[model samples]
Target: MSLFRKPQPITVIALRDAPDLVTSLRRALETATDAERPGLERALALTEDVAERPDAELRGRWVRRHLDAAGYEGPADSVNAIRVLRQAEPGLTLLQALTYARETAAAENTPL
Candidate 1:
């Protein structure tokens, strides 16, 4: 037998059906088109990459990177990011949702 491991396709669910963070973030980033990929695209991509692999330290790094890229520069902004992302409004792609988030953030003095 060989020592090398095999590759498996990451299981993906519909955005609406995503049960948790891995699936949810995957669907969120999936909505990001090639050009539309914003500041934290790599973090989004990295988080998805590690979902199957599941290294806690590695996952935390990327998750933090994602939060940082969303302009969550300080503690207050980060808190707002959490609130914005958790809203879960229907039928909007992550990018669209992000736009709404940014709009809302403007009023709150934060940037999503």
Candidate 2:
């Protein structure tokens, strides 16, 4: 058997189900300009990538990088990001949700 194996997918829930979270994301995205939005977009993409491989350690790494690039210092900042995204696109995916959570947790000054 091969020593390496594929990582498991990260299960994620829909943003619509989490109305409060959706609102939060929308607000966060609003603060940035179109040029600066790429960081948030990349963060969202990383979330989708991690969801496809939830168990992979790389997921966390990517999330942290994206969070920093997006100017999120902690959970509160992430909350703001989510709010911005939600306001921009109500139909955002679950991957976005997972990404937001991971970034928020990493950004948090205290242990979550």
Candidate 3:
């Protein structure tokens, strides 16, 4: 233990998928970097809200907005940002974040 330091509070969000169904994704989230796990959850909440729309442009725009909010943006078509967002938000699974953000995506966030 560090005598001169304290641990920061991490926001961990559990998933609602069958444990076996999302075993891999669950482990990924569990072992993800402290910065990543919650960020991914945030992205999922954003994706779930508007993923079924027929508006491709709107989705893209929303993705951009979320990226900005999550501080995940970089150069145009940032591969890193896309990779994180996809993995964080049910990219290859049917899981859902349990602790959904209280406010909708349009609301301001306190920097996760």
Residue-by-residue lDDT tens digits, candidate 3, 39-84? 7666555555544433433444545565667777564244565554
Q: How many backbone clashes does candidate 2 have?
A: 19
* Per-candidate count of clashing residue pairs (backbone under 3 Å): 0, 19, 0
Candidate 1 per-residue lDDT over residues 54-103, each given as its tens digit: 23333334334545566555432344654434342334444443443444
Which residues of candidate 3, in runs, are more than 4 Å off? Answer: 1-54, 92-112
Stretches of candidate 2 off by over 4 Å are: 1-56, 76-78, 81-92, 99-112
> Residue 107 of candidate 3: its Cα lDDT?
31
Give per-residue CA lDDT, model 2, range 1-112, as digits (tens). Answer: 4446553354433222234444444566689798868876665555545445333234344445555666666553356656544444455544564565555455445454
The TM-score, computed over Cα atoms with residue i paired to residue i, of candidate 1 is: 0.24
Query: How does model 3 score by TM-score?
Result: 0.29
Assess every candidate by TM-score.
0.24, 0.29, 0.29
The Cα error of candidate 2 at residue 70, in Å, is 1.7
Sort the predicted structures by lDDT, highest score first.
2, 1, 3
The 0-to-1 C-alpha lDDT of every candidate, in the order given, reads: 0.45, 0.51, 0.45
Pick by lDDT: which candidate is best? 2
